[model samples]
Target chain A: MIDIFTKFSGQLFVGLGWTILSSVIALFFSLIIGTVFAIMEVVPSKIARFIGRAYVEILRNIPLLVITMFFYLVIPKYVMKINGFTAGTIGLTLYTSAFIAETIRSGIQSVSGGQMEGARSTGMTYWQAMRYIILPQAFKIVIPPLGNQFVNLVKNSSVLAFVAGFDLMYQANSIASTTFDQINSYLVVGVLYLIITLPLSYYMQYLEKKLA
Target chain B: MSMIEFHDVQKYYGHFHALHDINLEIDEGETVVLIGPSGSGKSTLVRTVNGLETIQKGQLIVNGHDLSDPKTNLNILRSDVGMVFQHFNLYKNKDVLENIMLAPRIVSHIPEEENKKRAMELLEMVGLEKWAHNMPSQISGGQKQRVAIARTLAMRPKLILYDEPTSALDPEMIDDVLQVIKKVTNESGMTSLIVTHEMGFAKEVANRVIFMDQGQIVEDENSASFFEQPKTVRAQQFLSKIISH
Candidate 1:
């Protein structure tokens, strides 16, 4: 393990950087996508609700690797040419967004129905009630579950390895292949993931406590 | 002019009729209390005035807006009509001041400074000026209901509806909330429709009391006369049972 760190430190760091970058990009885009779809699911319009439900159901049921492969192999052949990293990030975002949408929709539903009625009886338009009263409360209810999704998303970025996206798992594969130190290589990457996830878990716990 | 008019209004939940031929009119500044046994449709009738509950038939007009018409903007009507719920549904996320200020600022576009000033005045009226920064969860049940009333008053609505506002509070907390309600309603002379089992508060604050039974009005009379000599057999029985309890 010591030899692997010293000899291939530069490559390891590069992989770490790519992994963090992809995770950040995926997290930002997925949260926005998820929230929008979650609202769509609950809005009064049946058609919008149908679209939101369909999107979550379809994306959630599919394997993450299959989604990445479609972006990598299928999209370039037909519509536009994109790199392995782009494909992996897009797939990660879409996959994670479905779970986030479900989490947030449940949060929105768990809020007392009387909150909406109270806001509405004060003469707020439906959307205004949703924006000011419902969403703020819903987000608080969803934080812990949302944190779990974020951590899972970071772990699932390992799907990038299959598509040569050069994330940490991709680097671990390459280092292990070259050095024949598979156990040590994978172990180092595992530690790097722990570094990203443990703080996130503790931060979520802190937030829940603060909000409570 | 009448503040609210329900002409042969009908409402149904599937096959179960919630309100039946609710032909009633409330004059401006009139305070009416509605009392009934559980499932008697007093709440359903009050809810229709602001279009929180839709009617299936007949003309329901409030503040000159015909709620039976689809084109009528319920939001505009609601801006002039405020409702207090059985649960004292203050915005749990907001402090007392914010809860009071939010509708006036958002719905009516009241200036922020003016909104704050008016909200503080309302908090003072409810005897909760010291609790302006407290969240709803931090307050006692009576305090929460008072804050809820202050929130409704901050909108300066022409009409107010109280739907069992104190039923959820403890016995000891009930009188404080009732006192705050009586002060606001009496001082403002706002038209009000209240649904409650507190016959004493009804006698004290209501000019007229309406009794509902199984989705229809059974009795409508002056509070003094009704309390002394309830006309209907149902009303007499209900009075005796409630008074005994």
Candidate 2:
């Protein structure tokens, strides 16, 4: 691992940078998509609820690799050709969003029972209670789970490697095959992944504490 | 004019009858107390007046809005009605003062400065002026109930419902909550319906006492007359049981 780290430091750092970039982009888009779908699932309208449910069910149940491959292979073949990194990031976002939607929806549904009644009894409309009382508390409740999702998103950025996105895992694969030191190359990349994820996990815990 | 009227109102929770043939009238400025066994529908009946619980049959008119009609805007009707829960249910994220000021600012569209003034006055009325900045969790159960009452009164509701407001309080704390409630009803003269186990508070604060059993009103009488001689056997037994305990 030390030899791999010293010899291919430049290549490894570049891969790590790409990994971080993909993860950041995917995380941002997924949260927005997740929150929108979660709202759709809970709204009083039946059509919106169905569409949200279907979206989540289809995306989360399918294997993430297949989704990425479809975007990479099919989009470039028939439609406008796009790079592997864009395809991989899009795949990661949609896949993670399904799970994020579920997490947020559960948090919204579990907001303390009396909170809604208290607001409504004061003559506030249902939307008013949802906006002022329910959503704020629900956001607090989801912080821990949302943190988990974020960490998972960073790790799942490895999906980029399969699409030749040049993330850490992809670079590790090239270095291991060339140097014939698979164990050291993969181990170095694994440590780099941990460095990114550990801080994210701790940041979430800090946020949870500050809010509480 | 009557503040609330229930004409042959019936309510059910999936085939279990929660209220049966409720026919009652609460005039403006009347203070009524509802007393009953644990599942005798006292809470259910009071909840109906505010459209919190929907009746499957008959009419409920609250502040001149016919709740039985689907077209009636519950939001407008509820502006004139307020409810205090046994659990106190103050918004957990807001400070005590914000809890009182929110509805008036948002629902009633009151001006900001006036809303703050009224909120502070309500906090003072409930004897929690110093605790205005505290969160609901930082306050005691009694203080939270008082805050809940002040929050209700901020909307200038024409009628207020107390659903066993002190049921969740500690024994020593119950008196403080009851006293605040007594003062609110006496001074404001807003039509009030209370569900309570505290017979003494009911006798002192209520002009009328309603006795309910098995989802029906067994006795509805003037508080003094009911206390002097309950006409129904069930009412007498209930009062004696409460008194003996």
Candidate 3:
């Protein structure tokens, strides 16, 4: 037991690097997808809103493992060959985007109807009002919820392990299987996850204070 | 032709029948005051001219655009006919100067310095020149409404719609806003449609007074005649109730 703990401690730092990589990739793409979907959801046309709604509903309801597996196992067979890290990062982006869309949509709705009317009355088109007035106010409203989605995306990247993604969880799984030290290996990974998530959590808190 | 006309206009909110067959006209540079009970559709009538609220059936021609026609480009009409809301609806996120300058810069596409100059001029007109940098949240209701008026003026609209402009204001603050409004209408000759409960302001500033009840115009006359000899029973009843309080 002591030997396993001693070995795992040094390897845990290696796992931390993978976790950080996964989180950065996932956060960047999720923000892009989330912003696109958020804009689509608020668009005037019925078809645009329907398409946005369909994407959010379908992605949000499915489990992260199922989505990761679809990208890892299904896509590679039918379409192009892709690595596990690419598959997992794509899955994390899609899943986190759905939640982020919901958060941003609610934020947009919370802005007063009068603001839209005021902007429109001044001859601004719908898109212009949304871009200049509505979205800025909505961003202030959704900051806390958006922060939660980012933190959850980091944790949810563990779904990568199911498909041989070289993220922290995958490294922890391999170390446990080879050494027959499941408890120590997972404990190390848990600490590594905390290292990534704790700072992210604090950073979000700092942002909320600064913005408020 | 009249600069503005409402012919047999009607509006319904889920069968509530908010405005009945309303017919009216205002000539160029005419300032009309609409006064009535709370649910009398006074606000709705003025809002329709700006195309803020659509009329269910009837012809509303304002500044040459037919509002009843679905093909009318309302954004263009809105630029010609600006509205001041009851709540002052100043952009809470923007300061008074930005609130005044935004429409001219974006909608009118005026250059920044020119727009800023016009915004400052309007702010001075409304006596809010010193508070240009203050956010709407930091200002008093009267100051906010004055800023809202300046914002409307910045658009250089042919007509201004005032929907209960002073009703939401404090009693002392009401005179300040009313004074600014009077100064604008007197100086600019910009046609205006004001919906207000301030009978004194109505009598003082209005060229004509319209009394509405249950969505129909009961009396339309000069402000002096409307107050002195109200021809309709409904107008008399409304005046008695308003003046008694």
TM-scores of the models, in the order given? 0.98, 0.93, 0.95
The positional error of residue A74 in candidate 2, measured at the CA in angstroms, is 4.2
Encode model 1's per-residue lDDT on B64-136: one tens digit a residue: 9999999999999998999999998889899999999999998999999999999998888889999999889
Interface RMSD of each: 0.6, 0.6, 1.0
Distance from true position, residue A101, model 3, in Å? 0.8
Flag regions of model 3 displaced more than 4 Å. A1-14
Q: Candidate 2 lDDT, tens digit per residue, A1-212? A: 89899999999999999999999999999999998899889987999999999999999999989999999999889998888899999999999999999999999899877998899899999889988998888889999999999999999999999999999999999999999999999999999999999999999999999998
> After superposing candidate 2, which stretches have Cα over 4 Å from the reference?
A40-48, A74-82
Global lDDT for candidate 3? 0.88
For candidate 3, give the DockQ.
0.73
As for candidate 3, its clashing pairs are: none
Per-residue lDDT over B1-245 for candidate 3, one digit per residue giving the tens place of the 0 to 100 score: 47799889989998899999999999878889999999989988887888778889989899899998999988888887888999888887788999989888888899999999989999888888999999898899999999999999999999999999988888999999999999989999999999999999999999999999888898999988888999988888889988999
Candidate 2's clash total is: 0
| Per-residue lDDT of candidate 2, residues B1-245 (tens digit) | 99888999899999899999989998999999999899999999988888888899999989999999989998898889999999999999899999999999999999999999999999999899999999998999999999999999999999999999989999999999999999999999899999999999999999999999999999999999999999999998998999999
- Higher-DockQ candidate of 1 and 3: 1
lDDT of each: 0.94, 0.94, 0.88
**Correct interface contacts retained, every candidate:** 0.90, 0.73, 0.63
